[model samples]
Target: MAGVAGNQPLYICRNCKNPIALRSDLLSKAFIGKYGPAYMFSHAMNIIAGQKEDRKLITGAYSVADIYCCNCGEILGWKYLRAYEMQQKSKEGKFIIETAKIAKEY
Candidate 1:
């Protein structure tokens, strides 16, 4: 883990200094339909999301919020929730951070 100014490892937008998430709370990977692979985060800070658009995908079904960086308005990723009831739903609601849009901030 990398350390920031106060010993916290953070995930920040690559295009700006906007903090997106804490390293400790980030999940390794997530799958979002046509968007493909993304890093999963339980919580992301300093982000803005457009209106949630509900859609069904081959992987599963979800209502996703197109999330972006609050500082620079860069597309970060999506916050999704299972729009329909599932027999076995794991990650019901969570933020998916696109790996390419972020960098480890230390």
Candidate 2:
């Protein structure tokens, strides 16, 4: 889902219409918990950094912070795979945002 003008589409919070990310940055689709379908983003904008949380995945991973919408304080997503401190070869964090919570601006 590209954006208007045939460029990167804007991913905005459905509750407040605040910009969250761009479709071009989308990495993959995932279904987690009861949140339904969500998309992984290489990067996200306008996010309020929160606390770090632990996750049990494979060898386990942690989120750098619980991301929230800067405008409405809504839980946008999380930045995960923050094992850079242990494994230098590990990639940086990835942003995972629920597709239901946001809309594509096109």
Best-fitting candidate, scored by lDDT: 1
lDDT of 1 by residue, 1-105 (tens): 243335888989999877789888787665542455678788888899889788675665778788889999998888876656475265556788877888887
Q: What is the per-residue lDDT of model 2 for residues 6-46, given as tens digits with 9 covering 90 to 100?
A: 57668899999888887788878753523667787888888
Candidate 1 residue spans exceeding 4 A from truth: 1-5, 30-36, 85-88
Q: Name the runs in model 2 displaced over 4 angstroms.
A: 1-7, 31-34, 57-59, 84-91
Local distance difference test scores for all models: 0.76, 0.72
- Cα misplacement distance, residue 4 of candidate 1 (Å): 8.1
Which predicted model would earn the best TM-score?
1
